[model samples]
Target: MEFFPYDVKELFKQIESKPNLWNRSAHEYRNKEAREHDWKAIYTHFEPNFDKMNRLDQKEIGECIMTKWNYIRASFMRTVKHGPPTRRPYVYYDHLKFLLKSDVKAIDAPHLDNNDDTLEQIPEKKLKVSPFLDEDTEIF
Candidate 1:
């Protein structure tokens, strides 16, 4: 069985232990979700104009896109490597961010190297041809 962080369980237990605490905690948790949703709405304000953006702005947009792409890729890697989470407060998102920020370059470097090696391994072949050969050649 998977285990949750001790503090998370402790907080849940505390809320369950008292009726007033349970009510307050439930309200606070729901409000926290609402706040996060509002914050996400604010992120939309930074929308970039692809055509008008300068090189640096484009680069920044590219980096953000790459970061999110890497996060998704790393999440899959984590699920494959560590198995699925079984409890609340799973650290998958945090782990994804960490891998995107730190491990992505190293993880992708090997794949790039392998691609180069594969290309290099293919043998170069040359076919011989007559420079002045006509369209038709007479043969008995």
Candidate 2:
């Protein structure tokens, strides 16, 4: 079954219930088994309509959901890193504002900041004059 915009919104709602799918700091997000379990929960939510033809397998459904999630995430990150574009933001932008909580930390993360130490120059060693060296010798 083709997912309409509303269906996608419902999917996001389901994702909201499962932090592993969106919250990176969640322990489940780092655990492969836990993540797969959460994915199963997400895919199951759409089983009724999605499996009407029994054409889509669990993996396919998971991929489709993840693809949508990735697109929305990328769009959100863009708006966060840069300002909103001339066009309006994604339809679900407001619904996904929860992302800002995590993204704000990432935006202000230390790695993104410029360090003063990196700008400091190391002292150069001075060359000593050798008494035995010929004056005619060209350093170049």
lDDT of each: 0.39, 0.65
TM-score per model over all chains: 0.28, 0.63
Q: What is the lDDT of residue 76 in candidate 2?
A: 73
Which candidate should be chosen as best, given TM-score against the real structure? 2
- Per residue, candidate 1 scores C-alpha lDDT tens digits across 28-137 of 44565654443333223234255476778756654553354345455645653454565333354333322322233223222222343212232334545566766575
lDDT of 2 by residue, 1-140 (tens): 34633387777788888888777877777888888787777777777555453645656777777887888888776765565665565567667766654445444323222343222222344667688889887665
| Clash pairs, model 2 backbone | none
The regions of model 2 sitting more than 4 angstroms off are: 1-6, 49-56, 108-140
Clashes per model (N, Cα, C within 3 A): 0, 0
